[model samples]
Target: MKIFRMKNCLLGSAFLLLLLLQFSCKSTYELGRKRAHGISDNRLYNQIVDSSLSYKSLWVKRFSAHYESNGKSQNVKGSIKILKDSIIMVQINAPTGILEVARIYITPDSVKIIDRLKKEYLTSDFFFLSEKLNMNVDFYTLQSILTNSIFQLRDLYERQRPFIRNFKGKAIGDKYVFLSDKAAKVERKLRKDKYSRLYRFNYQRFEIDPSLMKITDVIVREFGEEREMVLKYRDFVKLEEQKFPSELVFKVKDSIQSLSCKLKYNKLEIDEDLKFPFKVSNKFKRIYPD
Candidate 1:
């Protein structure tokens, strides 16, 4: 009879252990969701936007990166000097240790890119360096990098408002997911638009960490046909009263190409001696007469 009672006690102990494990897993998942949801709401978005716009000057190191299918990689290390409403100069170092200079002249009427490497330049009414890198970058991205401010999530949603018939957002585990009512419709419209080529690529998932207010992961789908890319941020620190990503990693489709960048900021002075060579050259007459 004592042996029988011992066996029963063991069985009960095992059952209790199983139950505890299940509860632990559920609690962990719930905590991740809660943390993610806390940051995705509208209030955090406004703080990010406000922080981005207050900076008038910036000086930082930027690493521009790219990948190819053959497992080859390219990195451009550079420093950027920004003078509000006037000029921006980017001095980049090629992988071959050659210096390539790009001067951007920003004005109300036009924007110009002067490439010193090839001695050629491009002009447009509204152009940003993100285009050169073939990345999905926009004004908000620029604002965030320049000012060390978090991106305003609301602004991103607002821009997509016209096409977003229905918006559903939720926190799943450690990730925050956003779904549009007419995702299919929006995809179709994007295909017909001039920017269709850019959106042709597919991503496995889109996620953001609400606590940091930063994009955490983007998994690429259909990688080779349309190269997939992911950007991860780390080592965030406050510089000049702003928080910025000190390390950035980019992973291409199939993991064929990978690039890691480390950023450093120094000698930050606002409204100092700055020059926008591109804008100045715009006023010069074409040396080679057409």
Candidate 2:
């Protein structure tokens, strides 16, 4: 009888151990899935595109910068003063902090970059930069990149206001479809096809956080083999009930040269009165690089 009781105790202990092991494994798997995918449902997925593009504010932003090109590298400091839709002023400083090395002022119509070290300035339209790098870039594109907003016009534009271009949006994994005016027409005609007509969209895939619907990464390759750019945002922070990126890393690759940039935000101020101090002295010569 004692032996029988002993055997039953052993069997119960083994069963309990097996149950614990199964529970532990299940918990670990759940945690990992939550971490990777965040809270998501069909509705959340559908709404993410609109939520990501809705962030709007004006203020000054600053970060420590690390940049590299080919093999050369440099540590620098930078700040941006944004007046939404009107202007964006950028200042880049060398590590020494004694003198500002570069100042860029971008308006809807033009871009002006002043090199303090070289005592020269380059003033040109968006086409100049686009042609020089063989990339499709304009004021809004750069603004969206800096602000962690959607790059595609369909998501970026507000529903109440008239859209600059006709865009049709749909969700795809971590990205959203941004069909252009021409592409939207193509999509309507090709809807009957079994294969996805997603190829007709104007914008490429842009990755975003599932929960917050904030832009987390973007890779621009539409311009083809001549140029490509990759941007990744990490270390997010919540400010003013909005998600702000604490770290941004970007790489721009072109036939002539490649540039890599990493930005670590030390300070961020939103909806504050900001000042933009930008002017090129008469002593500075104007230099144009095409």
Q: What is each predicted model's overall lDDT from 0 to 1? A: 0.40, 0.52
Ten-residue stretch with the least lDDT total in model 2: 18-27
Query: For model 2, how does the per-residue alpha-carbon lDDT over 189-229 read when each residue is reduced to its tens digit?
Result: 44766224433233344554545666666655433244556
For each of the candidates, the C-alpha root-mean-square deviation to the true structure, in angstroms, is 20.1, 20.3
- Model 1, global lDDT: 0.40
Provide TM-scores for the models: 0.51, 0.65
Encode model 1's per-residue lDDT on 42-67: one tens digit a residue: 54444334544344655543433332
Over 4 Å off, model 1? 1-34, 37-40, 47-53, 61-70, 83-88, 94-111, 125-131, 135-168, 174-229, 251-273, 279-290
For model 1 the TM-score comes to 0.51
Q: Provide the clashing-pair count of each candidate structure.
A: 2, 0
Q: List the residue pairs that clash in candidate 2.
A: none
